[model samples]
Target chain A: DVKVTQSSRYLVKRTGEKVFLECVQDMDHENMFWYRQDPGLGLRLIYFSYDVKMKEKGDIPEGYSVSREKKERFSLILESASTNQTSMYLCASSSVPSYNSPLHFGNGTRLTVT
Target chain B: QKEVEQDPGPLSVPEGAIVSLNCTYSNSAFQYFMWYRQYSRKGPELLMYTYSSGNKEDGRFTAQVDKSSKYISLFIRDSQPSDSATYLCASFTSGTYKYIFGTGTRLKVLA
Candidate 1:
């Protein structure tokens, strides 16, 4: 089974603190994505990486950035945590050979900002 | 206008009931349609994907897409409590890595 792993399943951070969410996929997928899911808003893409050292801003990329240093790992960075940023963060990965390839997602990390 | 729209229904039904979930899209170029189910506190899991503008069935689930109407539907037969979750509909176009997702409809299959 393809596995996508996030560093933390749950996280709590103080306002103004920097946060890092890590995602690693074992399927050797070329595409990785970060999304924040909010109640009634669905899944909003934050950022995505199609290859190492390449990143693209999604619909809601403000206050967030991404790093893809290796083929199997992608990281989402929050410059400064705020109460409004508390939400469920999801990581997903898919191969490039198929544009409609199914995404394998991590369990997700629910962050609470205080 | 939003590219994709779905009713976020907290639809309730008894076990064995047939459930239908639907989503409409404004993007006519979306050639790929997909359905995902997400349990509480868990990530969304891919359930069905269809590229053709017709119907595809797997097990007790059926995914139907009508490109002319720009609408998609998911049908669940003999629904069970285990099938209760938030169902999300997504659409994708060629050459784009992004898939637009709907707000998701929540279903409760009471046992």
Candidate 2:
């Protein structure tokens, strides 16, 4: 089975702290994505990487950034965390870029910014 | 207006009930529709995806799409308690890695 492993399951950080959420996929997928899930807003894309050193801003990328230094790993970074950024962060990898391709996802890391 | 819209339903149903989940999209450029299921405290997983305007079935689940009305539907026959989860609908166009998603519908199947 394809597994997307997130480095953290839960995190607690104070406002203005820089946060790093790491993800690693076992499969050799070319597409990796970061999304934040909030109640009533669904999952909003933060950023995505198509290959190493290549990243694109998504719909809600204002406060977040991503780094893909290797084929299997993608990392989401919060330059300066805020309370509004508290949410469940998910990492997903897809063999193809299309919605038709299945996106294998990590369990998620719930962030609590106080 | 939101590109995709769905009712945020905490729809409760008895086991063995047939469940219907729906979403609407306003983007005419969306070429594919997809459904993702998410359990509590877990990440969403892709359940169904359809590229054309028709019904596609897998096991007890059927995914239907109508481009004319820009409506998408996922039907579950004989729903089980294990099927309880939040269902999210998404749409995508060609040459892009992003998807327009609707707010999810939460379902609870009671035994």
Candidate 3:
């Protein structure tokens, strides 16, 4: 079984503070993604990494960035956290882009920016 | 228009009842369709997947896709309390890594 682990389950930060959400996958998958889930908005991709040091912005990448220094780890960074950035963040990984290979996701981190 | 559209339903059903969930897409290029189930405070997990236009069944779950109308459906038979969760429909174009997701429908199966 594949294991995707997010570093934190709950987080609280003050406004204007920088926040970091970390994720690690044990399967050495080549693709990693970060998404935020909100009521009525569903899950929106924030950023994705295809390979080490290679990152691509998804639909809603503003106020956030990503790091992929190693194949097994991907991190999402909020330059300046705001109340609007509070959300349930999820991390997912997939071996490759194929019909049979769906993404395996982590439990998620619910961040509260106050 | 949104690429994928789904009613964010808080549909309530009694145990052993049949539940149906649906999604519609505006993109004709999407050939891969998927349904994910998300428990409260947890990440979404893949529940069903269908390729092109067809029906695929796994145990009590069935997934159907209609390419002509760009619609997808997921049916659950003999639903249980454990089946209470948010259901999200997703789609992707063949050969692409990105997927578009619909707003989830929250289902509550009462015992």
CA lDDT of every candidate = 0.93, 0.91, 0.94
Cα interface RMSD of each candidate: 1.8, 2.0, 1.1
After superposition, candidate 2 runs with Cα above 4 Å error = A98-100
Q: Write one digit per residue (lDDT tens) for candidate 1, span A1-114.
A: 779999999999999999999999998899999999999788999999999999999999999989999999999999999899999999999888365576778999999999
Best by lDDT: 3
* Candidate 2, A1-114: lDDT as tens digits: 889999999999999999999999998999999999888778889899988999999889998888898999999999999999999999998877664465678999999999
Fraction of true inter-chain Cα contacts (below 8 Å) kept per model? Answer: 0.62, 0.73, 0.81
Better of 2 and 3 by DockQ: 3
How many angstroms is residue A108 displaced in model 1 relative to the true structure, after the best TM-score fit? 0.8
Model 1 lDDT, full chain set: 0.93
In model 3, the Cα lDDT at residue A5 comes to: 98
Candidate 1, residue B79: the lDDT equals 99
Model 2 Cα lDDT, one tens digit per residue, B6-86:
999899999999999999999898888889999999988888988969999999999999999999999999999999999
Query: If ranked by DockQ, best first, what sequence of candidates would result?
Result: 3, 1, 2
Residue A73 in model 3: shift from native, Å?
0.5
Q: Lowest-scoring 10 consecutive residues by lDDT in candidate 1 chain A?
A: A95-104
